[model samples]
Target: KPNEIVVVPGKVLGIGKLDHPVTVIALDFSSSALRKIKEAGGQVMSFNKALETFKDFKGKSVRLMKQ
Candidate 1:
């Protein structure tokens, strides 16, 4: 979904492309990944900040991607 938030426990790489804009929260991100995400009009943030911002994300769906 466009408004959906994707959280990654590890680092996000730039091997692939994002089709739509979304929010991404991860422990860390590669420099190229950050640039790609921004180019795709997505927002990226740290996991700690995500937790602080989305306190009510308990029922939301989260898919973990393995690198």
Candidate 2:
């Protein structure tokens, strides 16, 4: 979806490219992945921060991407 926040339970690796801007919340991320995400005009956050940002996150559209 467009303008959606992606939550990853594990680490994010730098292996591919992002076409559009997005907000990514993950446990951890590789340095390259962080750089790439920023370059793509995306925001990266931690799991805790995500939870804090979205207080009522019980039933939200959160997609998980695997490596």
Q: Give the alpha-carbon lDDT of every model.
A: 0.82, 0.84
lDDT string for model 2 (1-67, tens) is: 6457888889999888887778899999999999988888888999888878988766666778775
**Model 1: per-residue Cα lDDT at residue 33:** 94
> Taking the tens digit of each residue's C-alpha lDDT, what string does model 1 give over 1-67?
7657887878888888787777888888899999988888889989888878888788776656565
Candidate 1: Cα lDDT at 1: 70
Q: In candidate 2, which residue ranges exceed 4 Å CA deviation?
A: 58-61
Candidate 1's TM-score = 0.81
> lDDT of candidate 1?
0.82
Range of the 10 consecutive residues with the lowest summed lDDT in candidate 2: 58-67
